[model samples]
Target: MITQLPDDFRFSGPSMELCTLTVRVADLADRFRFTLVHWGDQLGPATAMLVKLESGRDAALTEFRYAIERHGMKGPVVEVEAQDVAAVGVAALVDDVLGALRLSREDTDWIAPAENKARALDLLHWWAQTSWDDMHPRSEQRE
Candidate 1:
């Protein structure tokens, strides 16, 4: 199980309108990791949350596709909205993705602290409610 982000994973570039979080796996055997990209602007009332499988993980990807299919969603990238995030919480989002991948927390290793996840959900809610004119971009100097 993963308890932290992989050492090689990193984030770069602007983050005001988008956040991409990823988990990576090093072996086969149907093991998988996920990439979640959330994006929004003041003009849009809802943030788009795109959930995908990490590249080169074919077994996991196939399983995820089937799972989403069973759930009535299209394959590979499942798009959700800010409202879903607000209602389910960030941990639930992770759980959903892991479940689709046929994985569980006991067998996966990912880092998502309660405080950080809550803060992310709060930010999503704030972005959903704020208008473009009233929105202030976060400082580029800060993470």
Candidate 2:
């Protein structure tokens, strides 16, 4: 299933825009496993983050781990679960990522601040752009 986020939906950061989310359920070990991809533009073309959620009744289970593949290398994975994560929190997390655009390790700068800041801003700028143009024609265009 594909879900298109609101067109006006956006935040500031250096990841990428919150594009459509694709969710697929597969039979893994006789149990259904959900594979959700947050598709959007990065440096070029588009990129995706592999999302996984641990099953639980508590809304906290909505917290998911994400991995981004850059140049065949997977970036660090982090846990991002918050109270505002509704039923479609996975999609919301995409916006959160785009808004913050900070990796798990980058939460703090123990090393060079200048270099890290530049990199973070670059990622955030690229991610902060809108993905409305990338959407299909059938998508609803809400002003």
Candidate 3:
């Protein structure tokens, strides 16, 4: 599914304006692929995250979609805009991704430069592993 960010969804940050954010989900044989496209001049390149689960692909997709729907526009598309919004949509999505994969923050890698494609894939691999628990444990509670 693709969701277009509202034109009014503005936050102070990058010098470039955000044109659109395309979220694509594909169900593969063994895993589900999620691609987030930040389309704009200087917004950054697109990134893909792979998620593999023994079961509950539907549930994971549902939760992920919910996260995007709920907080996708609450913050900026990049980290530079973190100061303006108390809760970043990207951060929230990270939390949701971690929750869905049953992984901790330290367990996964993140896009450091905010536009690194390799690092983004690394992040996906680290978080895509199966967890021992069936339900997602909150990050705060994990510690």
Candidate number with greatest lDDT? 1
Model 3, residue 8: C-alpha shift (Å): 32
User: Sorted by lDDT, highest first, which candidate order results?
Assistant: 1, 3, 2
Looking at model 2, residue 20 earns an lDDT score of 23
Q: What's the lDDT of the predicted structure labeled candidate 2?
A: 0.29
TM-score of each: 0.33, 0.20, 0.21
Per-candidate clashes, comma-separated:
4, 6, 0
Badly placed stretches (over 4 Å) of model 3 are 1-88, 111-143
| lDDT of candidate 3 over 41-103, digit per residue (tens) | 343333323233232121112113333466563212222223211233334444444455444
- Kindly list the per-residue Cα lDDT of model 2 for residues 17-123, writing each as its tens digit: 22221121111111223233333343433222233223321111111223223432222222232222323344445434333332233331121222333444544
Model 3 lDDT at residue 92? 46
Worst 10 residues of 1 by lDDT: 12-21
Q: How close is candidate 3 to the true structure, as a TM-score?
A: 0.21
Point out where model 2 deviates above 4 Å: 1-32, 44-72, 82-143
Summarize candidate 1's per-residue lDDT along 19-65 as a digit string, tens digits. Answer: 11232222222243333333335432221222233321111111233
Best by TM-score: 1
In terms of lDDT, model 3 sits at 0.32
